[model samples]
Target: MTHIRKAVFPVAGLGTRFLPATKSVPKELLPLVDRPLIQYAVDEARAAGIEEFIFVSAPGKTALEDYFCAHAALERQLADKGKTDLIERLAPTRMPEAALTIIRQDMPRGLGHAVSLARRLVGDEPFAVLLPDDVIRAPKAALAQMVQAHARTGGHMVATMQVPRAQVSAYGILDCDEDAARGRLLRARGLVEKPRPECAPSTQAVIGRYILMPDIFDRLERQGPGAGGEIQLTDAINADVETVGVTGYAFDGERFDCGSIQGFVEATLAFALDRPELAAGLRARIDRLAGNDRFAA
Candidate 1:
């Protein structure tokens, strides 16, 4: 069994939805509370024992790369100022010099194409891919749970969540057979991207986390443009349903879709409230706002 030592982060998306703010700063760098979105994803991956980090980035994403880079001058300044707490806070952001790899994806193809670009670095090992847009808050890191599941069953594994029937079309719906023995585990028979609600096979939807085998590289390479003339990763995974086999694990977590404005605001408040320092102030504000009928509407 290949331990999931490496993790891939697809950060090449332009984040057109955020527009002006993302135009200058990579959306992954946008702060949820104080830490950037990408930082949270990296922290989660680290908790799962992922040793190497690979980022699929685009031209304007230099800020994302720099965020992980060492800032020696700033560190020295903090030390001189006796700001030990600040230094410790920044410690988690540092990575060993050789542990990070960034691959540039010039064209805004699709998730499949972006993932395929990492083939040279990922090589033959089964690796994990995390989309930073989905910020999941859970007792145990979501990827860690999936990694544990992969240890039991050696095929590809993806994190799934039960979405409302009406919202099924917004995600990659999993067509699965329930594992009688393991309640949360599902044997993925197929995957459909943004299918009509009536056409959805199951309410279980594929989220941003994926632990996939190396064979998926070949599948994505051979898969032509799908849906919106862009290669879809779901299409590649679906193609290998019979051969490679895919499994879905319904993760225990609250997933916030940071890709949308509403979700972003909600996630900010959720994460802020999670911190011991911010909970009281935020909760009081929430109470005050709830009292205002105009705000309620």
Candidate 2:
């Protein structure tokens, strides 16, 4: 089987949910604790052995491109100040010269359309697609787990997580059966894009992570508008179920939908609480706030 070396990040969304904050800054550049949202997704891709990074972005997202570039002036300032620790912290933000590619998605058609724009960069190899909105915290990165599962099963794979039955309409629902050999892997029979709760096939909803064969571009090209009158990636993947086959890997992780204000704040608190330096103080503040009558419902 071909190795999955390339990964695509679709960052073209307008991020209207974030209002004034996203008006000037791309949503992917929003800070989660210290690192930007896109950084976490990139880190996860690196953990999965993804060598090439392709970002499908829109016109106003130049900041996203600059974030991964080397800041020589800042580096020199840090060196002059003898801030070696801070310099070391900046290392991961620098991307290798030839490993990064940014493509323009001229229209805000949909996720499928954004991904389709990366075809030339991805070429004929299998690739991974990660949406920065879904920040997943796990001992083992979700994409890494999917990469391992893909190596065993090939075809196409998606990250699956169980959500409340009532919330299935918010995500791409999977119609699948358990893989007998691999308990955590599910053989997807079909995919439903944002189906109503009454019509949902299962509670296992597809998250942002995906491992797809290059042939998916063809299906996407022929695909018309689906749910929400946009080209839904779920619909394209569904079209391949009978032939190429899709697998669902139930990843062990805590996922935060950072696209919304509530999820973003929740993720910020969760990540801050994970840091040893901030944990004790944050815990005390949280405890104090909990007991304050001003915060009473």
Candidate 3:
């Protein structure tokens, strides 16, 4: 099996959900504690043996590229101050600078269109698509799990999780053949993008991680808008699954939907508690706030 060396991150949309905070800053650069949201996704891809990084970005996103680039002046300043420890932290992200590339989406066409734009860059090779908004914390990185599954299955793989029945319509719902047995992989029958609650086949929603074959570009090119006026990635994936088949990896991970405000707060809290350096201070602050609110009440 060929090792999947590239990963694409579609980050061009205007973060209307985040409003003023994202007005000047891209949402991917938002902090999940000390690291930006994009860094978590990058770390996962790196863990999965992805050597090339392709970021589909737009204006005001130079900072995103810069985040992964070496800061010569900053490194020198840290070194001169005898701050070798601080400099070490920035070293890894700077290595193999050529491994990174940025492409512009230019408009908010849709997820499928954003991915289609990468076809020329990913010609004839399998690639991973990781949505930074889905900040997954797991024993095994979600994309890595999908990559391993794809090697065996040799088809498209999408990371999935069971959502509440009522919440199914809010996600890209999957229709699976029940006769299919369960394992590390699954064969998807069809896919629906934001289907109505009554119309959705199963609550097994597509969580933002995918390992796609290059053939998806052909599907996306002709895929039209199903729900909104913009093309949907689910439609293209679903179209391909009819013949290519899709494996739903019920990924072993605590999935955080950082695409929304509540989800972002939840991810921040979960990630912070796991950190040895930040946990104690954050715990104390939380305890003090709870006590103060109780006293006032």
lDDT of each: 0.91, 0.92, 0.86
Score residue 204 of candidate 1 by CA lDDT.
Answer: 91
How would you encode candidate 1's per-residue C-alpha lDDT over 46-126 as one tens digit per residue? 999999999999886788878998889999999999999998999878898789999999998999999999999999999
**After best superposition, candidate 1 residue 216: deviation in angstroms?**
0.5
Clashes of 1: 0
Once fitted onto the true fold, the runs of candidate 1 whose alpha carbons sit more than 4 angstroms away are 179-181
* TM-score to native of every candidate shown: 0.97, 0.97, 0.94
User: Over the stretch 101-121, how does candidate 3's per-residue lDDT look in tens digits?
Assistant: 899988788888889989988
Worst 10 residues of 1 by lDDT: 176-185
Candidate 2 lDDT over 203-269, as tens digits, reads 8999999999998999999999987788888899999998999999899899999999999999999
Query: What RMSD, rounded to one decimal, does every model reach?
Result: 1.4, 1.5, 2.0
Clashing pairs in 2: none
Name the runs in model 3 displaced over 4 angstroms.
Answer: 177-179, 292-297
